[model samples]
Target: MSTYFISDIHGCYREFKILLKKSNFDVKKDYLWIAGDLVARGPNSLEVIRYLYSIKDRTNIVLGNHDLNLIAVYSGIKENKKENYFDDFLSSKDSDKLINWLRSQSILKINEQQKIIMIHAGISSQWDFETMKACALEIEASLLSNDYPLFLKSVFNNKINYWNSSLRKIDRLRYSVNAFTRMRYCYPNGKLNLICKKSPNVVKYPLLPWFIISNKFKEKYSVVFGHWSTLKDTRVPSAFFPLDKGCCWGGQLLMLRWEDKQYFYQSYLG
Candidate 1:
């Protein structure tokens, strides 16, 4: 059986399905790893979530920022934004079930056998792989806990840009969530630059792509991430793979066959 990695579905269900067909993905045999953002921006958030839920056994997912926001909106912690186009999804009868499933999903996944790490956004330059994994699990625990609504309500803080082990539990969780779902750029000293969403080339120095900064993790793993569609053609090291092709914004959807690293693209028609 083969494995595939893709990200930032953004409710582009048509393109998502077409890309899978184009890649010859076999649900029974091939495993699909989704870096997340299963909803928002496209016309079929409901369809996208339903299909993923149907095939969840064959798929592995990590929650993206949009996905987390969807959960927050559903829990009444945040309002549903019109631009996100989540009405159909939120109004669905299965919305509660879907959101619960999403909450149970983790923020990070590691395949030790393949030496691959799958996350929605970039990793923190200040955290080693083990620390990253630990922080991710901590967030996952919070998400799945009974107090998840409270967690969602407090998780969006951007004030804590730097990672500190001694920070309060909530602060640490928020930082880890941002690092895993919203991060793009980092200051020279390893602080998160969460406000900037532009591509790396256009941004001046001291605000480099998170991957460009050094971390304590040994150079043995490849990080497969999504969430920064603006990264577009920005070339990163071979160890870092970005799969967001901006499909919901009139761009194409991309899928990478993990076995051979072959990429498949499906241009958006809607």
Candidate 2:
């Protein structure tokens, strides 16, 4: 069975399905890895969630920032923005079920056998695979816990750049969520910038892309991520694979076949 990776779909249901068709993805035989942002922005967010849930057993997903935002909004911790276009998704009868499934997804996915790691955004340089996994697991656990709404409330709008073992439990969880789903740039010393969303070439000073600062990890394993659409076509090492091509912004949906490292694309249909 072939494995394919795609990310930052952002509810572009038509484009997503087109990409799958373009790549000849066999639902019964092939596996799919999604780097998240499964909803928001584009039209048909509800349909995207329904389809993904139906094939969940054959899919691997890491929660993205928009996914987390949807969860928080559903839980009444955050206000839903109209620009996210989540009205139908939130109003659906299956909204609760879909949101629960989303909450159950981890922030990071690792295939040790293949030496591949997938996250929504960039990995923290301070975190080795073990540390990253531990942090991700913690966030997963929190989301699954009875106090998940409280957990989401604690993490909302909170940003933690540096990792400290002595941090409070809530703080640690917040850091993990942000690092896995929203991070973009990092300071020279490995602290996350979390602000500048511009392309690396346009950004200077002490800030560098998180992948650049965490090159050591990339050298050991292929790091696949999406959150940064502005990262389009920025050449990096072979170990780094960025799949988000701004499909929600009228670009194209991109997918990578792991076996041959082949890239597939489907232009935005919306």
Candidate 3:
């Protein structure tokens, strides 16, 4: 039984299906770990979510920023923007079922046997495994709580853009969410730079990719993450693996077989 990791599928349902068929994924034996952004941007968000929902038992997903935004919009905590592509999904009869299941997903997962960590985005350089797990659990609890809508509403307004163990309540949760779902570049001191979305080569110095600046946990565990599609080429950090190949942006969708570290790709045809 193999375990495959993929990320940033956006809404390319056809490509998702093709990739699965090409890989000959066996649902009963092999497991799938999605780094997230399972929907949005492409043409078939509704179908994509429905397909994933059908295979929920065999799939492990960590929520990405777009997925969280979908929840916020569904919960009436945020306004849906026209540029965002989920109208079909929102109008579908199974919308509620899909949204609820997506919300129930986690922001981080750890495979101790493989010595790997899966997150939608990078974790803070300052946090160790225990602290990262604790912070993630705090947000997970809030998302699963009865007042989750309230939590979503509060998360966006707080400007606590850095990680601090002393941060309490909403501020703490918001920081954790951003780090796990939206982070790319951050200062060496663990202060996040949320606006720079360009490739790391073009990004000015002093602002480093989270993986490069994150020293405390460097080389400690293998990290598989998505969210920054602009990162085209892979790195040799030995611990950092970025799988978002920008399939929704006319690039290829990538999957990594964790056991052998081999990659498979499907080009965007939509």
Candidate 4:
């Protein structure tokens, strides 16, 4: 069976459905890898969540920023902003289950058999595969635990630049979440740049996209990531695959078929 990687649904139930049907998704056969953003910004957050839950057994997911925010809103740690979608989700009968399931997702997944590593956002250049797996597990466990609300509120803030081995647990939790879910650009020395969300050329510093930064692990590793939908889809061979295509901005939702090469499908959010 073929394997596919899809990213940045952003609550577009229509697009999601279109992609699923058009791809001939077979729950028993083809594997579906979701690069996350399972909710927010579209008109069908609740429906999308419901649908995914119905087929949850067949899908493997990594949490995206919007998905994490949805989890926070559902858990009462963060209130839903008016601009943000998901009122229907907040008012749903199964809101509690939905929140738990969302939080249960991981920030990265690697399939050794397929030679694929999927992350919601880029990983730090400083981290190798083993380090990434370790850090991802630590963050995932924290998200799935009872202390997640505290993790979301105090420690989830991204302003912290200093990380120490002796830092408090909450601080470590926050750092892990940011590093896994929110990383985009990173300085040459690996400091995360959270403010600049534009494309790479817009930046003037030596800082660059996290995967582009030279590191001990560079040139020998493969990375597949989403987020920064501005990068859209690049023709950068398989060294780096960016699967987010701005579906939330009325652009197309993208899916990469990641076996022989990168076959793909798209659904316009218009």
TM-score against native, each model: 0.98, 0.97, 0.96, 0.91
Worst 10 residues of 3 by lDDT: 212-221
Clashes of 1: 0
Per-residue lDDT tens digits for candidate 2, residues 2-76, read: 999999889999888988999999999999999989989898889999999999999999999999888889988
Q: Model 3 over residues 148-248: C-alpha lDDT tens digits?
A: 89998888743677877888877888889888998898887878888889897677878988988746555667889999889886353778889998999
Candidate number of the best TM-score: 1
lDDT of 2: 0.88
Q: Which stretches of candidate 1 lie over 4 Å from their true place?
A: 216-218
Best-matching candidate per lDDT: 1
Better of 1 and 3 by TM-score: 1
What's the C-alpha lDDT at position 144 in model 4? 83
In order of listing, the candidates' clash counts read 0, 0, 0, 0
Q: State residue 218's C-alpha deviation in candidate 3, in Å.
A: 3.8
In candidate 2, residue 194 scores what lDDT? 73
Residue lDDT tens for model 4, 146-174: 88877777756777543455757677666
For candidate 1, the lDDT comes to 0.90
Better-scoring candidate (lDDT), 2 or 4? 2
Sort the candidates on lDDT, descending order.
Answer: 1, 2, 3, 4
| TM-score of candidate 1 versus the correct structure, residues matched by position | 0.98
Q: What is the lDDT of every predicted structure here?
A: 0.90, 0.88, 0.86, 0.76
Off by over 4 Å in 2: none
Error of 1 at 58 (Å): 0.8
